[model samples]
Target: MNQRYTGTAIFLHWLIAVGLIGVFALGFYMQDLPLSPDKLKLYSWHKWAGVTLLVLIVARLAWRLSHRAPELPLTMGPITRMAAHAGHWLLYGLMLAIPLSGWLMSSAQGFQVVWFGVLPLPDLVAKDAALGALLKTTHVTLNYTLLVAVIGHVGAALQHHFIQKDAVLSHMLPFAGKA
Candidate 1:
C-alpha cells in the first residue's frame, strides 16, 4: 500500500481542518457580542461557513467512496484497526451531523440559511421554538464532541508517527516518505 494519501485527499483533509477551526473559533467568540449589526454579520458568516462545510463534506464523502484509502500496515493489531475505522466513521458522522443540526436549528428559528450569500438551502423542519431549542442544544453538544474527536484523531496520528514509527500517519500526508 502507498504510504501517502492521494494529493486530492490530502488537500481536502487540510482544507476541512482549517475550516473547522475557524468556524469553531468564530462561533465561540461571536456569542459574547450584543445583538447588533456586527453580531448579526458574524452570525451570518458562521451560518454560511457551516453551509459550505456541509457541501464540502458531501463531496469529500463521494470522493472517499470512489477512491480507495491507503491500507493499514501489516503489523497493526485488529483492535487498532477497529479503533481507527470507528474513529473515521465517527468523524464522518460529526461532519454530516453538525451542519445539519445547525441548519435545522436556524430553520426552526425562522432564519434563512444562505450558502455563501448566493444559493439558498431548503429548511429541514418548519419553524418551531421548542424544536429550535432542542436542535440548538444538539448543535452545541455536537460541536464540542467534534472538537474532542479531532484532538483524539490528531493525537493518534502523532502516536503512530512518533512512537509506532508506522505508516498510519504518513498515509494521510501528500508527500510522506515510504514506510
Candidate 2:
C-alpha cells in the first residue's frame, strides 16, 4: 500500500481545514460588531470566503471520489477504523452544510451574494426575514458543530501520531513516513 495520500489530497485537506477555521473565527468575530459600513464589508468578505470554500470543498469531494485513499494499517483496531470513518464522513457533511446554510440565510435575508464582489450568485431561497432568521441560526449551530468536530479530528490525529505511533496522520502529511 502507498501509506500516504496523494499530493492533491494533502493540499486540499490543509487548504480546506485552514479555510474552515478562518471562516469560523471570522463569523464569530463579525457577529458582535456594531452596525456600520465596516460590518457590512466584513459580512460581504465572509460570504465571499464561504462561497470560495464551497467551491474548494466541491473540488475536493470530486477528487476524493475519483481517487483511492491509502488504507489504514492492518494493525488498526476495528473500533478505531470505524470511528475514523464516521469522523471523516461527519467532516464532509458539515463542510457542505455550513456554507450552504450561510448562502441560504443570505438569500432569505434578501442579500445577493457576490463572489469577492465580482460575480453574483443565484439565491438559494426566496427573501423571507423569518426564514432568514431560522437559517442564520442553523448556520451558527453548524459552525459550532464544525468547531467541535475539528477539535476532535485534530485530537484523534495527535493520538494516532503520539500514542498509536501509526502513520495515520503521516498519511496525509506531505512528507515521508514508514508505510
Candidate 3:
C-alpha cells in the first residue's frame, strides 16, 4: 500500500488549512475593531473567507468519504489509533460547525453573506440581536476549540516524526514518496 496520501487529498488538506488560519485570525482581529468603513470591509472579507472555507470543507469531506486514507503506522496501539480517529473526526466537525456558526451569527445580526463579494448567501436565521450575540460567542468558542484540537493534531504528527521516527507525518507532506 502507498505510504502517502493521494496528491488531491494533500492539496485540499493544505488549502483548507491555510484558509482556516486566515479566516480564524481575521475573525479575531476584526471582532474588536471600531465600526467604520474599514471594519465593515474586514468583516465582509472575513465572511467571504468563512463561506469559501465551508465549501472547501464540504468538498474535502466528500473526497475523504470516497477515498480511503493510507493506513496508520503499525506501531500504534488500538487505543492510540482510536484516539487519532476520534481527533480527526472532531476536527472535521469543528471545521464544518465554525463556518455555519459564523454564518448563522451574521444572519441573526441581519447581515447577508456575499461570497467573494459576488454571490449573496441567504440568511440562516431570523434577525435577533440576542441570538446574534449567543451565536457570536458560540463561533468564538468553537474556533478556540478547533485551535486546541489542531495543536493536538500537530503534536501527534510531530511525535510520529521525532519520537516514533515513522512516516506518518511524511504521509501528508507534498511530493512525499514511500518511506
Off by over 4 Å in 1: none
Candidate 1 lDDT, 60-121, residue by residue in tens:
88888888888887888999889998999899999999999999999999998888778898
Clashing pairs in 2: none
Better of 1 and 2 by lDDT: 2
| Index of the highest-lDDT prediction | 3
Weakest ten-residue segment in model 1 by summed lDDT: 1-10
Residue 13 displacement in candidate 2 (angstroms): 0.7
Evaluate model 3: give its TM-score: 0.97
Query: Which ranges in model 3 have alpha carbons more than 4 Å from their true place?
Result: none
Kindly report the root-mean-square deviation of model 3 from the true structure over all alpha carbons: 0.9
My TM-score estimates for the predictions, one after another, are 0.95, 0.96, 0.97
| Candidates in descending TM-score order | 3, 2, 1
lDDT of 3 at 133: 98
For each candidate, what is the lDDT? Answer: 0.89, 0.91, 0.93
**Model 1 whole-model lDDT (C-alpha atoms):** 0.89
Worst 10 residues of 2 by lDDT: 170-179
**lDDT string, candidate 2, 1-179, tens digits:** 66788889999999998898888888899999999999999999999999999999999999988998889878888998898889988989999999999999999999999998989999989999999999999999998998899899999989988998978888888775555
